[model samples]
Target: MNIIIDTVVKEYDNVTIDIDGYVPIDIKLVDSKGNPPLYWRVGDGSKSLLELAVLPENGFLSAITLVMMDANSIHKVGNNQVELSCEESGLPIVNLDLWKDSANNDFSQRFIDNFNCDMQVYISEDTILIKIIESDNVNWIHCGGGFYLGLNEEKNITHLLINSLTQVDITNFTESVC
Candidate 1:
């Protein structure tokens, strides 16, 4: 569903994070409040979570790595809070909607905490590109969406987009989902 903020159409195709390897996708998000976009990546749309990122409106941010746990379920609470939990624990692994009044986030911590390895961060085309180095030869990684991982076979590196693309709100998922 395309979110509308201040009567301005906010769609995913407007801002796309085109990386070198994987195919860029226009992220679909639901921003309840007038806040920024919230990206959730669940592995195969199953229980395992690959990443959960909150791009802080692309402004000032701290370099702190906030270690977050993987969650299975995510939902909005009272239109002001987001609770993510695993195994129906009734407790959220990480509760969002609390960072609204806080400072901006670099999202480096969420990468490290999710992958459990050291990663590089880069910002280009108004999106955060996370560089993860793996020794194994891998290709075609899909957790959130389709990814053509072998962008460079020699490098064997994967760069995941950490932010959402903004476009004019047009596509409606209520009738036919993309």
Candidate 2:
């Protein structure tokens, strides 16, 4: 993943903190009014502490880490929404805005907590890039997709454009998925 170090200051106090180049992702936090508060920021890329603490033996985020590239998209239930229609190819058209967040890493917990909808997590596997859809019960359902993780000409890590779920044949269910 590409690491671009950036700093953010608290909205109220302006206390700045350095976020070591985390990728920003757009997500919608659902509010009490059944509306999703749309916003963007660097997400917690590591496996959740809750997952680690609860399920020590399980690799809960292993599959997630695979499919979701650095610059991916997430949506929640709000205003000034950007429209991205999926083509017949079953892949969303590449839109850069959807991949970036407004505040970098200094995301607000209140904004997220106000939304009832769970955050969406995407992970690309060796071959299968899947969206880890969290169910009402917090169980995950794999929505398959594909993306490329590689180094660019400058030796900088970049996410190359790979196919999406519909384009990739993830049905093989074999070790050679990648």
Candidate 3:
């Protein structure tokens, strides 16, 4: 007797989907040798994990709280942006933008220009204002604003900011922080 079966495996690449009713839930950063670097959980229940595999040995990290949010309604920003209100004075808190155009993709500038709205991006404590000057021949995305935390001119602040915010178990922070 002989038996045979046919099967096919499907592979799907990760893509960014529009998040609805998402606010800022919590941000956590963790650093340890040979461990995953970053984990993010948005208020809309969207989540992602990023691993920095190429770091020096014996790296240690902890979450540094620059700002805190309202306790009762922690994750309710009306618009797509994760806006915040300052707890101290009841003022508007600027939400940090974490999205970036792919380095290999040259369509970012053109896309922004066609829209004609200033792209606001936040990295660490700084808000970056971006305007598309040209896209056809330029190789890099040139925009103004860098290093809100006031680092060295040559330092890769974007990388540091991203690393700091992305390395943690954010989904379980409510339990862990308690």
lDDT of 1 by residue, 134-167 (tens): 4344332222222112112442224443433222
Per-candidate Cα lDDT values, in order, are: 0.28, 0.22, 0.20
Model 3, 1-178: lDDT tens per residue? 0001111112211211111123222222222345332212112121221111111122222122212122332221222222221112111111111213322334332111112212122322212111112122212211111111111122111111111122232222222222
TM-score per candidate, chains pooled: 0.21, 0.18, 0.16
The per-prediction tally of clashing pairs is: 5, 15, 5
Better of 2 and 3 by lDDT: 2
User: In terms of TM-score, which candidate is strongest?
Assistant: 1
Give one digit per residue, the lDDT tens place, for model 2 in 1-178.
2221121111121111111123122111111132222221223443220010001121111111121222223221222121222212211111122224522434342121111212232333322222222222211111123232222233222222223322123222222211
Off by over 4 Å in 1: 1-116, 134-157, 162-164, 167-178
Q: Any runs in candidate 3 off by more than 4 Å, and if so which? A: 1-25, 31-59, 69-151, 154-178
- In terms of lDDT, the best-performing candidate is 1
Candidate ordering by TM-score (highest first):
1, 2, 3
Which residue pairs overlap in candidate 3's backbone?
30-167, 37-167, 38-166, 38-167, 39-166
